[model samples]
Target: MKPSFRLLSTVAAAALVCCASSSVLAQSKFVLKLAHADSADLGTSRKAVMADTFAKEVKAKSGGRIDVQIFGAGALGGEREVVEGVKNGFIQAGLASGVMANFFPGAMVTDIPYLFPSDEVADKVMDGPFGQKLSADFNAATGMHNLCFGEVGFRHFSSGKKPIHSPKDLVGMKIRVQETPLYVTEMKALGAQPTPIAFPETYTALQTGVVDGQENPIPTLIFAKFYEVQKNVTLDGHNYGIDWFVLSDKFYKSLPPDLLKVVTDAGKVACAEERKVNRTFTANGNKTMADKGVTVYTPTAAELAEFRAAAQPPVIEFLKTKIDPKLIDSIQTAVKDADAKK
Candidate 1:
């Protein structure tokens, strides 16, 4: 028997509703919450650009199958907390810096004083075999997948009280540093008292004289407005800072092969873009800081050598107690190999 017109219309309406629901489901196969403690809206922020690029690329390439939600400016929490969230599956991904050493001690190898002489060498070492091995080890140890290594550029000293031109300048100053042993050891060796302060608290610390100065990349000095509080910026380039694009292992496993490839590929693309942006900012950093009424001092080659001499030995000895000496040797070898390449 043929159905009546009204009955046929009702069946068609039901089919349309079912199709719409399925379409909605397909549009968002995964909802990824990526968080960081930086300005997402800031056009010049490398951290912000990194997160934004990853979100944009993943959404476009995934065809909306992956929904990326970015919470910047510590909307979620500090780097450590955000990384913890990623590890626990509360946050799908995050960009973590020095705090990563707390989770994976091996990461401290990257913090070795005077590690990379140039961006080219740093890129080669980090994107090559050394980085791959580190990534795999980080995943195995923390159960959080490191998508890629984005850069924070080379860290420099910024002081509100005085210009830091040599190790003597830092003597007795209370410098804010990440809550890690390497930084502490480095500061002590430099004859400064290292105060372990959270990133969010750093500005106030400097303003209130809780800390005399801090060390960070030039872009970070601008982004965090550290220049406002710190008048002196010493381009010591003490440490080659790195930011990890990390993902939850559980979330990673949930992705099918195609989607997984999309996320990982997007990570590489985003990391490269971040490095480009950061290097550009760093290249012009001296002038940028000077324009802001900050004293930008480029230490002489001899002065920088003094910094390396004072900081590296203690940090290396401390590292030997905490991690495999062979790993330390390997990273040094990797840096040498990378430098020799061109």
Candidate 2:
């Protein structure tokens, strides 16, 4: 028997309604787990604030439908493990530093020493087009959504034995670095023997004299108690370390459109707050370290020039061979444009 046209149309409409209803119901049941290797107290740490803010906003925007569970201080695992877990979908998200670069070699470009002149310059470059493109590229390659970049601040040299004012001073020194090729190459180019070590184990390495010194932001030195074992802190500000907020693409794609928007918006807000907190913490850490009897050394213009002149060429040449030369040029141009605006 042939069905009437009206009857067939009616049946199709009902099926469409059923599918729409099912999708809405599924969207309402989403949840995400975010983790990081920092303590929950945000007193002076921006990363902590970012993690907390993201969780709160996601819940509020999704009307508590999309629950975001945050684990701090390596509760889930270390940075590298957390990133891997995200990729495999065991964990939904994580905030990781350069160590995560080992999985994405393009990220290594940002870690080049003396590349950024100041915090202001770093902020301008990373928040601009270049950073946005890199974030997208990382997402495409790793199947992880790159939300926004958080700050780890500029890394400086701190040693127990000597004050580092120029490249010559670092000669033959065994300096601790993250397990990134760029860091190892940078340190080697500057005449220091690079020693790769995990962040959580750095203080012990310094204390036990397993390594002569290490480089990290002032706030990190204070937070991790590196100042206790290292007497001299040099404000060389050699490299800019950025923290990446990476989320599982599989999990994100499963979310409803509305919930996905909420997650992205929340990440943007959290990134801004985290930047402010990091900057303030860095400023205050200097004074805190001084009060704790750690000597702070600032290099003279001539001394800084010498270090820059020595490190830049080798890094530039090495990058050309490893990465697209045009990409390196674009990064340099972006940085120059950013500096000119200031």
TM-score of 1: 0.85
Q: List candidate 2 segments past 4 Å from native.
A: 1-23, 197-201, 208-210
Candidate 2 lDDT tens digits, 1-342: 256888998899999999999998875787688998878787955667999988888888878888888888889988888999999998988899866666777787786668888778888888899989888888877788889888888889999988888889899999999776677878998999999998879889999999999998888888898889999999988888888999997888887788789999999888888888888898899988899899999999888888888887788788777766777777788888899899
Please provide TM-scores, in order, for all candidate models, with all chains considered together: 0.85, 0.88
lDDT of 1 by residue, 1-342 (tens): 356888999999999999999997775499999999877765677888999899999999999989999999899999889999999999999998878888999998988998787789999999999999999999989999999999988999999888999999999999999877788999999999999998889999999999999998887777688888999988888999889999999899989898999999999999999999888887776677878898788888899899989999999999999888998999999999989987
| Among all candidates shown, the one with the greatest TM-score | 2
- Cα lDDT listed for each candidate: 0.90, 0.85
User: At residue 163, what lDDT does model 1 achieve?
Assistant: 90
- Screening candidate 1 with a backbone cut-off below 3 angstroms (N, C-alpha, C), the clashing residue pairs are none
Q: Report lDDT (Cα) of residue 278, candidate 1.
A: 86
lDDT of 2 at 174: 91
* Position 326, candidate 2: lDDT: 74
